[model samples]
Target: MAFSATARDSAVAEMNITPLVDVMLVLLVIFMVSAPLLTKTVDAALPQIVPPSLDTIKPLQMQLDVGDDGSYRLDGRLLTQSEVGERLAEAAISDPRAVLRVHASSGADYQQVVTALAEARNRGIANLSVQH
Candidate 1:
């Protein structure tokens, strides 16, 4: 073989990726080991026993509908504004825990629906819902 002085002192231009690969593998393992610990759930003691009440009265559910012609109907029966108020008052008196659902027809006025809901609130109905 011929002796070449040019190759003796010149460094190789190739990159050494072994250390990079080793560092990446170490980081991957570290993350994998700590991931499960980061996801560990809190140990809590939630209440499992609930007491039953014998005198609990079931809440009454009533539906009120607003007609397309701006009329008010209670439980599918047509009624005037005063009558609706009276019926709501009666329901409130009979069962203050009554739930009222106000339904409005597609052609019904928004004011009518709002008025019905307001009336239910005035009658001391805390639970009320509006439907279409």
Candidate 2:
């Protein structure tokens, strides 16, 4: 271009907004096409939490230990089978809902442990369990 002095002055005074309008329209079309794609959602299965029930809550339990010498101990106190039965009966009488959790030593007699459990049951203990 060969522009006269008057034409140059006129062009300088008028703003050429074609590029601006074209850029704005291109941006609008790009956003219009990408808007829905960006708004797309994925389906997910979320885990739900459940409140604990009475059954789920562990009961208050007492420990019964069987020593290597076939001796019985309730709460670290040594006792004979009859004493164990007496203690268990007392505990059962105190709290019928409580559990008697028995733990036998690795070298303990299994039959004696079973006998202790039977004693607890004989004393009207309904909640008898063994611990690992």
- In terms of TM-score, the best-performing candidate is 1
User: Candidate 1 lDDT, tens digit per residue, 1-132?
Assistant: 986777864656567999999999999999999999999899999987655663465799988989999998899899999899999999999988899999899999999888888888998888998889
- Compute the lDDT of residue 108 as modeled in candidate 1: 99
Per-residue lDDT of 37-111 in model 2, one digit per residue for the tens? 989999999997777685586656889999899998899999988888898888888777779889998999889
Q: All models: lDDT?
A: 0.89, 0.87
Q: What would you estimate as the lDDT of candidate 1?
A: 0.89
In model 2, what lDDT does residue 52 have? 67
Span of ten consecutive residues with least summed lDDT in model 1: 48-57
Location of the lowest summed lDDT over 10 successive residues in candidate 2: 51-60
Q: Candidate 1: misplaced stretches above 4 Å?
A: 1-56
List clash counts for every candidate, in order.
0, 0
